[model samples]
Target chain A: MSEHGERSAPGKGLVNGLAVTLKTMTRRSTTQQYPDVQPELPPRSRGVIALLEENCTVCMLCARECPDWCIYIDSHKEEVVVPGAARARQRNVLDRFDIDFSLCMYCGICIEVCPFDALHWSPEFEYSELDVLDLLHDKDRLGAWMPTVPPPPAHDVLGEPSKEEATAARKAAGPGAPTAARTARARPETPEPGK
Target chain B: MPLWLDLLVRVVAVVAAFLVLPLLVGQAEHKVMAHMQGRLGPMYAGAFHGWAQLVADGVKFVQKEDITPRDADRRVFQLAPVVALFPYLIVLLAIPLGPGGLVAQPLDVGLFFVLAVLGIGVVAVLMSAWASANKYSLLGGLRGAAQLLGYELPLVLAAASVAMAAGTLSLPGIVEAWSPWWLLWQAPAALVFFVSGLAEIRRPPFDMPIADSELVFGYMTEYTGLRFAFFLLAEYVGIIVIAALTTVLFLGGWHGPAAEHLGWLWTLLKVFAVSFVIIWLRVSYPRLREDQLQRLCWLVLVPVALAQLVLTAAVKVAL
Candidate 1:
């Protein structure tokens, strides 16, 4: 058996050597021309932070959850009417929200723990700046949408049928029925005491 | 111009050829090897598949830092690259590139002159090793000396066969006598010459002295930046010299169709072809064991070379 192993050694070695050479020849090169071709980062790629301003409820959850304390939020009380109520209710209005991305580790825990879906990961990685303070993204900078987002995966599109139906219904209804779907989707069984 | 002035012009022409042409040949070798292995090489460096890569590399190397080890023998460390580099340049003075392409007075003792000049490169390796004061460097230097000594005998014997057959040591004289190319006629001697040449240059399957993995870059472990680049340049230059010598002695030194008008072109093509094979062998084969390398030189190559030399002499006397 040992003699057989010795006899086959040279043959195996030749094959192994050729395999390595061929693999190196065919492998995709790791080098990238950074200034020329921008890399296509994935959907969840942690590059920078963006916010959905309309959906934010001023809960300050993102700021509270942030490990680095990079997120800063200030809010004030605002009147919001309860559904079918005569009197208005007081709630907190978000006055400021800022994220200093220079100090941010991009752990995505803030995004994950955000109840209002206000905080999101954006794929714009190129953010070089001369001033160290310029990298500190304030409320205005973080509020706008990123230019491009990787298209949602196929399974996500398939899973959200109501959203697709609502989009189709909106297209059919023309511009007149802006809030028709939301009104129709609201439950009527629960009654209000005063109206 | 006086005779001395004429000689100086010839020396300049030879130096230019040695310095410039080998770089072009090395570039061609890279492209050919890339094609054979199924890829495009250096397609963007210049207009045509990085033809100017060597030029770019040369500029970069010169602009790089010239570093020396703090503990090194500074004078010898600085001198090593110059010593390594100049011998290959001198060897090119003796090589006959083609008809009317003889650079200097073609000596009757051209073969011996080529060997003696090329042998000086080993001294550079030794100097680098000892001057660095590193154990691995010393081992590499010792290995280089032993390897060169072992291989040089077979290489000389192989060349002696061609000299004996042609009844001359002058390179142009040897080429002038070959009605058919000498390589085909003296097949055994050509084989011995090529194998020994590979060993002499320490190219792979015989690159024991500078085995990068085992010895951490061998004798050149301490050399960095421009000094290392010089050693690299000398290696490729040495490859070109060996290929040129092989062409002159065995492959009929530029004798081909259109013998006058296109002789230099044919000579360059042949030399480039041989150099490609050497580079291909480097990429294809793994390095041999040090003991195996020594054994192969002494046991196999020297005996084959000796036999060919004896056979060539006997045939010459009979003819």
Candidate 2:
């Protein structure tokens, strides 16, 4: 027998017997109580999709890259001639851009591929439905801004600033100012138009 | 009430206490670990630090779909958790938690009865492992059986020493004999008993059978839903029972500072204190390797327990 074996052998029976009790007494647990204190998800976690309609240029890029084929876009071409332009330019009018979120895997590829920076991840994960089709988000439904994902509470066990403090700090810094370095670091590189 | 009705009531009491106490202790273990590790534990489930978290977990387990592997022995796999759980309940019947705390006839062989019943839990573990027909489960089951065999001798020896010192196998009678407490007279036996008890439960350092990293829950590998929950419940219940047993055997069952005057509260406090110590040890140490585990039990614990037994006999003859 090995030194560890020899040393622990006579005592092996006792230790083996006490092992379970010792474990119950020891070991890091896996449970996190969610109702009284919400668990903190990591930064850049893809939860739900929120459309930033103001930033949308009706580019239909999100619809094209979606692997799930959940996004639906319908457009009509309208010709408008500029007074000084040599030729008339055709701008596609966005008639419909419906994203059926029911099929969305939250891969964020659509958000990444959107040239207009229209799609963003919303932190709300509590969406529940009686019907499957209720999750099928249409153009008008997708255009609405989701509720701001609650910032990590100050007392949060996962170690992030509370939502109130983060919001207050952001407000102090000015509207749309970078809230934290971590969040700023996660920002995707904006795509150039007409690529 | 009629004899059968009274027996039914006692059974219900034992079952209820066994179920509830483990949940409380499990929560306390989490809270204690969190405090020791410089973090607050379970502050969210209900009002005070996720007190209702276990209830939520129980509800979730009930709601989950109980799934069995297609290749598994369905009857045995389903029966395993019940087997694992039932022994703890049976063991609880013999435990004298306080002066009037026992739910069953306090047998002259109470100490042996608890140990014997606890042994059955290992069998359940083996059954589950074999029934699951999974490699991990088989390994886990095998480890559990081997572990029990290795640990039981020392555990029995330690209990025998305590029994010899107390001059009775009846748990209540033993408690009655200790003027100050049995632990003071039999410190060595207490130490051996505690160490062996920890092993018997397959606790940390020796928790190789269900080591999640290696075995992925061992015997419970193929179990899902409520079946998995039952296994977990059995483990926690086992922890509580061991702690309770420790309190009863050596710590002077319900005897504390003015315990007689304070009534059952003193007993509760003593049990809680013992339970907390068990939890504290878990937070303080990391796990031991498997071979190291086997060696430690056989080499160190067995000799120490035997020595204690011999010394107790010598002391008894001298007295």
Candidate 3:
């Protein structure tokens, strides 16, 4: 009993506690009954790391920034044939990208440091594995989580439009508007030949 | 019936009760405690409110590795669980569930026998404590012994007051002598006996010996597997024994409406109701500290028990 508990008439607190528990016993339990009923997680809830493979430039920024060194990346430089260029330009082609989820602290550093906007947070968390080694999610497996990734929540303060959105807005304004590329920073070129 | 056959039947009945009632109380505790805390306790095991949860626990306990400490007195350490478990089995025999020779073994001095046998639990605590060669175990054992010693006086005194009111020590005889007015007359002694009985069984508020926070399960720290399971079974059996005894002694055992035909039912209902109260008390009160435990036993319970004794004596003489 605390000092306050002592000041109440002796045994009154004991009776009151018993009454509280008895009353609680009659009320509906607050249990969520997980597995039977899915939880109502917020839209941007960080359940797992998802990958947008098409957006990855094989920059290795995410791998370098990962504190746990759980991320693995492998890429080889390939010559790209431009439609009308004198010299062929070289670009990094992604071969392998895997995240060892067993070692991941889920610090979001990998997602934050990715300049290509490849990594995203997905709310589909129920991917438990029987073996620890199986937790290492390859790029294909990570990409599978992309469909479950919810769109980013609307900003609390709608301050600055993203370059893509701003470019779209300019294009909509007039036919003689400045080209979208000049209006915004230069767009990163896609390495793949087919659209 | 042949005497041997009769004895065998009674023994079997007692043994079956000894095995079953404790499990029921344990399951009740699991559900009751959960609901009281606003949680759906166990939902998965039996597919129906976790009815087989304790059954699964029993299987798990059996599958666990029985570890014996290398430095421990292996013989005494192993024997402790048996000692802890068997006294309640013996005490259960004399508890009359209803009228007309309904008891398993109707002893003339059933109250004395029950009280004396229940005292052996402290020996079990001491055995496990000293045998484990752990300092915490020893401290818990010492605390258990001290608590039991302090509270035993009131427990016995309260029972004795009831014995005086009935003018007999036979449980069924006491029940036969009981009247509804005894509810008001013996209320104080009933309160003392029930509380002291809680202390005897080391139930919470009175559970200083096994203070998990301070003592790491006290005398049971080194126990594992089936040996540990035995100790848990012993605790549930202790609850049943206490509830049954409180029912038999104070609540007029099987004396209720339609008790002639449903005497045993009345006894069982009373026992389960008392057992629920025991669980409620555990849920309600934080454990009393050691000094508070002693003070409650000596200053409060003992005096109340003594006063009930005097009142019973005076009423008996005047009537």
Candidate 4:
């Protein structure tokens, strides 16, 4: 913001400005019709938290680790008789799972802390509610958002296989496959170039 | 044609043009300004490129609640919008769309009539500013007065140069005497007139009085609903008036090829073309600071306009 700048010609800046606007007038306008046309969000963009109800094992890790204290979980013990033994085994059955979206800070701590792959980010954000209470997504409502969760983006070309992919590959190789500890010791650590 | 019937038809046509053309310019401003800034402006009003956006706006303005401040002067405050708007209608009547007595009223001193009537618009600004009982409104009104004082000289002087060149004060007479070469001859006065006209109307870059960020719409701060709509309508009419005046005086109104048969069409085409430039200017420039605005008027526009007047005189004397 110079008050006065050296100019070779008077009104040159004014002419330049007019030329710029005229050029812009001929260019295509960059406006998107949001309601008439759905936007193309990035792959795996964070829009809303979704739940995989079947994958949830009644673990309280997500609820406990939530920074906003927005997640709620409740469960009851269920007794199941063993097939060929007199002893009975007690297991937890999920009775309630809710996320108070109105209070949720969307910090993603709950999804990160979940022991099981029970929560995912869905790129479907048009869930506005008239009442705050309506924003408290119950298990059924959270589960509905799961379908909108996009597949994770591809890793870099030179990146290592993901943990899940690696695990699955190792399983497919059978019992005779190289063990994790054996492979680690088999690859000798190379000395630094300077050393 | 019968004289009374002919007068009646002309009046009706002028009134129709007065009502419609401003709205058309307003709509063009919306679309043009939008595209200049890389946005689609009002794409859904008429369902096809927002042709009826201003019409829809008029309906919306009708539905709004009109409010009068408790401390305001009730009568004058209520009357301000009409005062602002009515003069342009009078000015429009004197403007000729073509040759052969195509004007609504055809005043003998049409240039004087137009300039005089255009001056009355600022009175409405003063009335609204004084009556609104608001500080911002008062500041805006005072600024409008100052702007008028500064710009009016150049505006009139530039127009006077053209009137001298044509050797007539009537708008149609000016057009009838116009030659294509006057485009170059009258170029300086044309620039001065157009710039001053823009300032007089308080269009952007000269919109210090109603600098929305500072004055909250200036003299129109307290206006709402249909009254406010009238002010908006007046602003658009001002643009049309200025553009038409510029066209008539400098651009050779209704003087294109085949102008005898298609004279009104040429006039309208020129008017819209000038209006587009007005909108283009608004999109291009930021509002000038108050001091800078005055400086441009007093230092630049006035001197150039005076030089142009002398040139016009010298050319007239030699001829």
Candidate 5:
């Protein structure tokens, strides 16, 4: 008996098998023409690690938190003059930064724990090399990949405004902040009751 | 006017049909199957859609080390490929390519000759399988022998229906006898022939002999380099033979309008059309299991072909 009770047929499976193949044979292929065309990657896809050089304070936080110990950082204390304050202030100046990608587990922990948004996951991962040693990317190479890192996704409209956005909005609302006030007007954020 | 020159010319033509044409057919198979599957097959070698890819592959195969098994029957292993390839070209010699019976030999019993010569390749396959001395190879050979034996019956019976309908056994003569189309008159027999012929060639829907997943490439497991290349070539050439025979028998070989002038071209078109259908079957159907293969041949095709035979005879007598 048929599933619907109208009619049952022998060898319907065979006909359906052929029909499926015929349908697939006519459908457009889902092949990605890689190398010639860039694939559409999600904004925060973890492909390769990148560094924002200016934001990296040589704090050694990324290196300490890294499970693989892939991140190596060096810095020297540089004295800077502070006008109308103490005679000189000493701050760590970044000297050398290297990421041995050969050892990188790519767990995104380094990017997560970074207090300063210095590390980002750039979705530009076509860095295959003949030699394993060539994969140990230095500061300049890591910094170069930062430009390829896509901007973070837009925040949820219905959700509470983020801390960064809320603080920036507060700054714009304060008197004498003119330039940021223009950006603040563009983004209409609902007032958080607690704030 | 010399007989030896006539023989030499015919030999060259056979060589051209089997050896030269298969390269183009192989290219077409790759390109067509790729398109059907929604991908570009070859884009590099010749720069304009990989025309030289086969040539490059041939060069690569030629360069590989010809490995032989430690305890193999060295002589049989060496000669099996030659056995596989040699006879089918002779079968091609007997087939008509155009109207007005445009064949090299056009012998009185050409149909029988073609079928007989085509069957010789099975021995080569068996020889390779047995010679390899591998258990898998032996199983593959056994499967091949059974498959070839099973399918050949229905194949011949299907052809018998065509012969009974047309009242002739010579291939070109059958073409001359066909009025509208052999396919219309002997549709069931044609189906039986096509399905059975696919089995004969050990192609998909019946390729239990070389079930790669199960038998590790079956009879060809131990072959390497040029020997393996020969077996591959033999299979493709067997496809050509099947296509040509189908064209001659069922499609009314070169019987198109203006076929006298464009007969060879029509023959080519029909042959390739049959080949395309075979490829279509390959893409659509999964390989039949060994038991399924046997059941299909014995229970289904053989009985159907016999019925079709009786029907054709009845129709012939009624007419």
Candidate 6:
């Protein structure tokens, strides 16, 4: 009954409303000045595709797997004498790597399928062109976005290093080096199959 | 003063009112309302605080395509904005800027003329809506008619109560009748006038006719280019006139210490002050439901206005 009576107080609601608006009117405004001030994007946000040329072995996996058939790759075999062996060897040297952005749907299948870790998602998505054909970015342009692809998020201090990093580190350290610390830290937390 | 000169002055005043006041009022509304809602409003287009935004907007409106729907009544659709805007511009002729014959004409029946001309805009709204042949526009037209029916009585009654107290139909006469405490004397009528006038102009809280969420720009939906600009201009003009009328009746026209010297300035200040409050009210209140709005006008405003009218007449006669 008291609550109902409060709601019925004639013009009280309107007065209260005016008071609220008046209070807000005096407070500092919260308008963002866009364009003039570029927004701070997250480091991990997927923006554009970047290519690491060194890691690419012309495996044709990204091109073969692309749903859009947008990734066009060309390569030629090069023969070279082995440094220690008595025989000559042939290797696929990359000739051309072009991603037709007009057709490349940015589905990230190319990035996911690169077995040699040859592709990355770069946070540099501001390449617009007047002509559609101009969007067919070649290897050099794709590689230009590589420097902007932020280094992978820092490894947590107390956590075990990733398998790739650990294996690479072990290889660099030598074959017989004991990976005892990593095993000790990880094995206890590993859940058994039934449990 | 020569007759031609007087005519020129009046024309200039009316024209200036149309051109200048709209821009000033538009800017003030945008800036003030933005502050009220915790926004920086317009920050570009004028070197500082978007002062030239209205000019840019005018240019944009002019350049836009004048689209006429294939099914629309071409003549009425074309004529609606001209009809809506000109009468309100003429209505300003009666409103006094300063004491001692500073108004455009200041007719003996000025209030009567103002009220009659005020109804023309609503007619234009309905005409444009009906002419559009759109279902939503038809609903908007119906809503406008319903609002006119619900609120017109209180609007007339509120103004009439003031006329009764003043013993004249002229706005300048009402100003003369006031004893500087006109607000206290005619407080109830003023309240009715403000609320009913909001309904009359189809402003927020009473803007069911232009309910954007449901009706998609309402009666002016199909209008484009300059025609749309005209409707927008008419709304701002409507707000100015209502504020000026309220000033004359309740706030005592140009009744301040410097009125003789700076009377027109005081009038401008008071008019904008009233407009500021209206904009504030717009931001503060949510749109009233159709049923709720009708109930307010009929159940509350009409009864109060009626009582105030009777009370004012009796007091006038007794005194």
In terms of TM-score, the best-performing candidate is 4
lDDT of 3 at A64: 90
| Stretches of model 5 off by over 4 angstroms after superposition | A1-8, A36-40, A151-160, A167-195, B1-4
Please give, for residues B191-264, the per-residue lDDT of candidate 2 as tens digits. 77787788788777567888889999888888878888888888788787888788777777777666655645
Query: Which residue pairs in candidate 6 collide?
Result: none
**Runs off by more than 4 Å, candidate 3:** A1-6, A31-37, A53-119, A128-138, A151-195, B63-78
The lDDT, on a scale of 0 to 1, for candidate 4 is: 0.90
Of the pair 1 and 6, which is ahead by lDDT?
6
Give the DockQ ranking, best first.
4, 3, 6, 5, 1, 2
Model 6 chain B lDDT-worst window of ten: B176-185
Interface RMSD of 6: 0.7
The two-chain DockQ for each candidate, comma-separated, is 0.08, 0.04, 0.67, 0.77, 0.45, 0.64
Note the chain A TM-score of all models in turn: 0.64, 0.58, 0.75, 0.77, 0.78, 0.68
Best-fitting candidate, scored by lDDT: 3
Please report how far candidate 4 places residue B4 from its true position, in Å.
Answer: 2.0
For residues B296-319, write the lDDT of model 4, one tens digit per residue: 999999999999999999999999
Q: State the lDDT of candidate 4 residue by residue for A53-144, as single tens digits.
A: 98898879998988888989999999999999788999888889999989988888888888888999998989999998999999999999
Q: What does candidate 4 score on TM? A: 0.90
Summing lDDT over every window of 10 consecutive residues in candidate 5 chain B, give the lowest-scoring window: B176-185
Model 1 ranges off by over 4 Å: A1-31, A41-46, A60-70, A80-85, A100-117, A129-135, A150-195, B25-78, B100-103, B179-188, B214-216, B222-229, B307-319
Interface RMSD of each: 5.0, 7.2, 0.5, 0.5, 2.1, 0.7
Q: What is the C-alpha lDDT of each candidate?
A: 0.79, 0.77, 0.91, 0.90, 0.85, 0.87
Q: Where is model 4 chain B poorest over a 10-residue stretch in terms of lDDT?
A: B99-108
Regarding lDDT, does 4 or 5 come out ahead? 4
Interface RMSD for candidate number 2? 7.2
lDDT by residue for model 5 (B88-167), tens: 77888889998775788888787778888878868987999999989999999999999998889999899888888877
Task: Assess candidate 6 and give its TM-score to the true structure.
Answer: 0.78
Q: Write the per-residue lDDT of candidate 1 for residues B115-195, one digit (tens) a residue.
A: 888788789989998999888988988999899888888888988889888888888888877757455658888888888
Model 2's lDDT to the true fold?
0.77
The 10-residue segment of model 6 chain A with minimum total lDDT is A186-195
